[model samples]
Target: MKVTITSIELKGPFKFFALSYRAMHILRQLKATNCLAMKKRGYWIKHYTMTLWKSEQDLKKFAMSGAHLAAMKASKSLAKEIRTITYEADSLPDWPTAEIMLKKAHVIHY
Candidate 1:
């Protein structure tokens, strides 16, 4: 199976609890509409979000879909900003669990 992972790095100071809540909201919203898996980590207030998609088309569809587009646009308006890079994996490879997915994703960026 193919997996598309999105790695996001937040640009400013953001309360962890608040961002986590927002992340959950975003993930739930995406999961309701598409096949999506999400994870997050931090570094000096910088944060990373990894979203797994079944395919590039699936990923694109969610990105261009109305609610997602609105949420992403709204995120930019917040004091914190984020940069994301999407990666394609032909297979899960060495990842045995979702945790592995997060570790592998952390090692990859555009």
Candidate 2:
């Protein structure tokens, strides 16, 4: 299994609001995608998503297309920090493990 984890910190209330609105749509789109498991964490300006996929290609396909792609573009300006990590796993990692992995992941600042 391929696991991907993402973390985002919104710039402010307005950016948060805008992204939250788009997030609703992206969540729905994720649910309909080929991911094996999807989980969301955090609230307010901080948010994280942990997803399990059959392959890296499947995750790339989703990330590069449709709502996910749109969200990525929109977030570049609205987010204060963005980070992600991907690894191969035999099964979905627990929330604690996911969080630790995210903390160790490299971050990008906008």
lDDT of 2 by residue, 7-90 (tens): 899887667778878889888888788889888877888888888999998999889988889988888888999999999996
- Measured with C-alpha atoms, the lDDT of residue 18 in candidate 1 is 54
Output the number of the TM-score-best candidate: 2
Q: List the residue pairs that clash in candidate 1.
A: none
Which candidate wins on lDDT? 2
Candidate 1: where are CA atoms >4 Å away?
1-18, 33-36, 79-81, 91-110
* CA error at residue 41 for candidate 1, angstroms: 2.0
Residues 1-110, candidate 1: write the lDDT tens digits.
Answer: 23544334444455555556666766666777556455556656556555666787877777776656765665654424444445666443332354345454434222
Query: Model 2, which residues run further than 4 Å from truth?
Result: none
